[model samples]
Target: MIDSVQRDSSLLVHFTLKLADGSTAESTRNNGKPALFCLGDGSLSEGLENQLIGLKVGDKHAFALESEDAFGGISPDLIQYFSRRDFMQAGEPEVGAIMLFSGMDGNEMPGVIREISGDSITVDFNHPLAGQTIHFDVEVLEINPVLEAANADPVG
Candidate 1:
């Protein structure tokens, strides 16, 4: 038995992600090779994977995801106000610039520049897709069954 993107591990695939505004956010079709990733990896959102399950090679699909199931609904806490001086100290912060900053736990997090006031710069650390629904267009170009995967695995 084999699973497509729904499987724990997918060898290769081609897909496109479109925002609610009908704009492409990401796509593997642009490249000649299909995108490949190990399942359960943080690379894909669970909600996005749910739509890909049970699909087979050459399957093309489109699905809409709610904010909660996608990057998760917008969290007020994720919004932070930083001092303009602090932002300048780090470097000249510009509107629409994405920044990398340390989280409270010291993990690096990415935040986008939203607004710049006199002394405060608002940064949104939430996933860009957070708080919004997204559409995914997928085409399964190939399926490497488990038997073939086992044969390729060194341990198997």
Candidate 2:
């Protein structure tokens, strides 16, 4: 192992995300491919990335993050009602099923069907892991320190 991970360094790590109940929610180790990420990149949330700082190669650690530190708690305003007719073309809307709906920006946004009331269907746009505590288990496999601007090639 070299030294501790520092800002701007690229890291290769295996991580597992689990809920309080010990049920695995996601894992990169299972796929046999370690995740590669550069510090300071937006790919990871600040809260989650902060937990990785100072870890060195071959280090294993777990962090517990509250709902606020992880994904924010569910927001009631994110739940919306849409007429049944609007979703007939896509397919049947079933409770607990996640579907992609066109957002105001014309991009697709995922929402889970929470309830059905006659002609009205309620969809919740909050993240599936919102409002919960998460156990983040990480193993740092490799760390590639970033070269200074003066020593690095802008393009190769």
Candidate 3:
């Protein structure tokens, strides 16, 4: 018998994400292979993860999440303007081009070019999907429950 998904269960699933307008944002179904990940691993938001706790193999589910529960609302602090000179070695900036910038913590963050003035370029660091509701369609392909240690005692 197949086990149901639990908080720490590892799962393989096929999923598709759509916008409120019914436009597909992303999907694994197109590739014909299920994606695998462990629960609570941060691959999905906590709100979305909580919804997967009781699914079994072969089960299909669909739901929608508001902006706050998904990528979240846009943050004004993430929008900033940089001097054009900083991108000199990279060539001229074009609007809508995504560029990676190193953070103070040494991790890279992607920023999309929004506008280019004479000496300033506006970059928006907010996620492209921010402020939009998301629709999710999911099919659970496999589930592996957390195994108990061999030395552990079972309680009746």
Best candidate, TM-score: 2
> Clash totals for all models, in order?
0, 0, 0
- In candidate 3, position 35 carries an lDDT of 77
Candidate 2 residue-wise lDDT at 56:
90
TM-score, every prediction: 0.80, 0.85, 0.84
lDDT for 2 (candidate 1): 64
Candidate 1 or 2, higher lDDT?
Answer: 2
In TM-score terms, candidate 1 sits at: 0.80
73-95 in candidate 2: lDDT tens per residue? 89999999999999989888899
Alpha-carbon error at 95 in model 1, in Å?
1.2
- Model 3 has an lDDT value of 0.87
Give candidate 3 misplaced runs (Cα > 4 Å).
Answer: 145-156
Global local distance difference test of model 2: 0.88
Which pairs, if any, clash in model 1?
Answer: none
Q: How many collisions between residues are there in candidate 3?
A: 0
- Ordered by lDDT, highest first, the candidates read 2, 3, 1
Quantify all predictions' global Cα lDDT against the true fold.
0.78, 0.88, 0.87
Say which candidate scores most in lDDT. 2
RMSD of each: 3.4, 3.8, 4.9
lDDT string, candidate 3, 1-156, tens digits: 547988777888899999988999989999897777688777777778877889888999999888888888999999999999999898998999999999999999999999999999999999998989999898998897333454566798
